[model samples]
Target: MSELIELFKDPYERRARLVPALLVALPLLVPLVCVYGPRNPILTAVLGLLGGCGALYALASVARGRGKKLEEALVKEWGGMPTTIALRHRDSTALDSVSKRRYHEAFSSKLGIGMPTAEEEAADPARADDVYIGATKRLRELTRGGRNLLLKENIAYGFHRNMLAMKPLGVVACVLGLAYGLIIAKALQLAPLTFAPGKIAAPGLAAALTLLISLAFFVAWVFYFDKDSVRRVGFVYAERLFECLPSLQPTMPRKRTTKSTASSDGPD
Candidate 1:
């Protein structure tokens, strides 16, 4: 698990993948922690074994996959990927005409290829796509250095995107925990971690309270998440990414390739 946990050193991995995994897993973890006091040797051993078994690694991977799938669907609903849409001559949702024109000028000058005209987009869309795709690639490379203006936006985008992706599962886990909490509190009349002055705390009430606490995840999903939220964050990231065009130093232009080299890359 240490090996897998180390992956979180990457901002995208932590904000976009691992944190969502942990939120979905929170319901189960909360009760366990409450039932066994935070200092319990038994709980610590269980976690160590679980961590060694790569459970956390698997969870993070699953969350990443789901988040990406959600992103794909949202792209369709929103008409295009944020960066791709912003660079298009016809799309005005992500950038104003003045800003888009400046973006076109910057990339065209830097890359030695014009942003495809609206007529070109209408006539041979793939050619236009190739131009936009190439510019996006360059933007990503350029954004990696300097102050990393784009990196911050990318992390913010990933955080919202992944959190939105795992929302249903997170909500379901919270619902189950809430039900269990009610059961323990009402039927069992147990106080999992109830403290009374110097008295030893019972584990039931605190455990139930932890379950209730998990519902905050559900409420947040309901109140804070939406497909538009992902799109908005993505566009912000895209703008910052493209904003790096001055970072591109001009060189002799290479011949165009026959193949459509454009491929989908995202903030994994």
Candidate 2:
């Protein structure tokens, strides 16, 4: 866990994975907090114990793993990855054919590799996909940093992707919280609306608030997350990545090395 302490400083990890994780985790903790009381030393000690044992770190790691898997699944569901789709000549959703041509030329120049030709890609689409994946990886390495707009776009995509990945767990936490809240409210004989003058205990009010919060989170997950939105963010990130091409210094073209050159030069 101490070795992973540096991970805490990574903005991508915190904002994209840890924050959503905590949102899901917090609702689950509400019931415990209610039972133990907010200022209870016992509750504080247990939290400390969990933190010391690296539970929170593990949760983030697990969430990140799931997010990655889900992202890959999404890419498959969408026919191809955003970057790959951008590189493909056939994917009109990615870019106009002329723009894609320009993009491929720039990428070939900057990345110091041959961009897949439409004819070649048509013959071997899988190989073309490999080339696109490699180019995207190189681009990411070249543009990695806080100041880069591409990195910001990457963070944005990651946040949405992970939030969607954590949606099921979030829903579970919301359900648990809502169930406990409703039970507590029913036991206390509290009405959601007051038709006449009635006093609600502090606990009843707290339970009702918890129910409302849980419902809000459930609604957000239901409405705000889906395949289309995630794909949109992915495309935006891919475009931002491609836009970094101009920033990279172009690689020198490889010189021709043919048998004719060997014959033209004096033998060593």
Best-fitting candidate, scored by TM-score: 1
lDDT of 2 by residue, 64-143 (tens): 77787887688667767787787898789877888788888887788776777888889988777777776766666677
RMSD of each: 4.9, 9.1
Q: What global local distance difference test value does model 1 have?
A: 0.72
Q: What's the TM-score of every candidate structure? A: 0.83, 0.83
True-vs-predicted CA distance for residue 82, candidate 1, Å: 0.4
